[model samples]
Target chain A: MKIKVLAFGKIADILPQQEWEMDGVVTTGMLRGQLEAKYPDLKGLRYLIAVDKKIANDDSPLEDRSEVALLPPFSGG
Target chain B: MEKQTVNTEEKPSHRRKKVFVEGPISPAFVGDSIAKHSTMMNIGAHSIFLGQVRKDVIEGQEVVAIEYSAYTEMAEEKFHEIREDTFAKYPLTCMHIYHSLGKVDAGEICLFVFTSAIHRREAIDACNEVVERIKQEVPVWGKEIFDNDQYVWKENK
Candidate 1:
């Protein structure tokens, strides 16, 4: 299944926008592990995963063609 | 018999601008906005939160400035959502939020939040909510610039 990943802030700066197709991954945690594998330097970065604008935890399941956003901590005031 | 006529005239005049922006925010601009929005009849209280840059030594490096960037489309959408939510939850007359987009130096104003309401309590509560929502939802990033032209990314904690 293919998933659309939108990364913003520090994560976006490191990883460009693109689509990823995983053969067996189905959870946010799995996607995060794949991302960290691609960019080992981001291993310590803290981020939040959101599915369709609402915050999602690591165990959240992903469906085919799901829209996910990876966001770093925000500093706006 | 006498006939009478009614005269209807539409006058075109200047309207107040809602948002203001600059590379560096001027105190004069904020003062002007406060003066223009103040009135003796409707709004009774105003609450503001001003975020300023700080010079600190992090990891033995001296910090200098901050460079801010945002996903414009998404950031605006989030700002609108926060504004609508604040209005729905509180009885506020008006609110304004402005943040620096480019490079802002140390000790300079980076973010400004202003809210006005019929009473002090609502104004304070709305102001806090707006700031919290912006930090939690907005897609803005700040890069810390040090004295030696080196940089590090700053994350909200």
Candidate 2:
């Protein structure tokens, strides 16, 4: 299944713009691997994954066309 | 101000609020908000928290501004949840949260959190709690742009 990946904060400095399509990714781990491999800069960044607008703290399931966001630490007041 | 009020109607408890303000929040806007609340006779106290962007010298470079971004869908969801939880925990008449979306220069107001209640203690506590929760829970990120034309991502302290 294809997934929609969005990048934010410093992560965007690497992936820039996304709605990136990663093919045949079954889990968040698989998607993470693919992203880390494609953009090596992502390897050093500390961030979290949000599946369909919610943080994937666990091994959350992702379906086709899932909207994923790579979010760094929040600094808002 | 009207736009903000429209988005903050906590009718069903699941409805999301628009918390993002483009660029820095102006003093006029803040003043207007407070003026609008004057007619609410039940509110005895209103605690307001204004977050000003600081000019910090880091690595000998002066930070000029901060550009903020967010996962809007998730941020709104988290904001709504935090507001609801605060409402449940305190006896607040209403609460408002506004944060900058784009570039906010040093010394400018970037965030405004206001809570109104019948008592001063509840209003003060709710404002602090909401601000704390938003900092830790929301997916908004700020990139500090230095005067030397360098940038660094900021983390919650």
Candidate 3:
């Protein structure tokens, strides 16, 4: 399975690319592990995963085609 | 782009509506909205909240602009939920929430929240609640761009 990822805020700057893909990821927790492992700099940043337009829990099951976003703390009004 | 009319009939109550603008929310646009609402005789009071990007000196660097980004879909859903919650809690005649995406310079408007009601208290309370809800719940982020290209992440208080 492959998942699409979108990065925002400091997380976007740390990541090499804003939008990309990862293969063999089936859950939010796995993706987090893979991202932190591949991009060690991401480990220093605090963020959350939003899967297919909603906040995702650590063990949230993911669809192969779902869009995942790495979001830092909100600052909107 | 040509001005678009508000088509409230298009979306069902459960469906989320769009609340994003490309850059800054202009004063003329907001004024036009106010002028349009004059036709609604039932709405006696209108309270609005406008968030402007401030130029703050942080560690001797002056902030110049803010680049906003979001978990787009999730933010929309959150906005819709806030709208519904506000309506249920207050006697609002109508509500409009708009936030800026992309770069907005200091002194420009970044967020526009408008709520109309039959009384002043209801309108003011709903507007305050909606603004706070958006700042706390929405998945939108802002990058503070400072002088000479230096930047910092902005966290709303």
How does each model score on lDDT?
0.73, 0.84, 0.86
Q: Which candidate's DockQ is highest?
A: 2
Per-candidate fnat, comma-separated: 0.63, 0.94, 0.94
CAPRI level of candidate 2: high
- Candidate 2, A1-77: lDDT as tens digits: 88888888878878857557767777888778888898898888788999988889636778999988888778886
Order by DockQ, highest first = 2, 3, 1
Give the TM-scores of the predictions, in the order they appear. 0.76, 0.92, 0.90
Q: What is the DockQ of the complex in model 1? A: 0.45
lDDT score at residue B148, model 3, on the 0-100 scale: 94
lDDT of 2 at B92: 88
lDDT of 3 by residue, B1-157 (tens): 1322343442126566668888888888888878878778888999999999999999999999998888777888899999998888998888888899989999999999998898999999999999999999899889899979989999978
Per-residue lDDT over B1-157 for candidate 1, one digit per residue giving the tens place of the 0 to 100 score: 0011111121111222222244556666567657767443588999998888788789999778888876555677677777777778898877777777778888888788888888999999999988887777887878888989988778776
Better of 1 and 2 by TM-score: 2
Looking at model 2, the pairs that clash are: none
lDDT, candidate 3, at B150: 82
For candidate 2, the TM-score is: 0.92
Clashing pairs in 1: none
Ranking by TM-score: 2, 3, 1
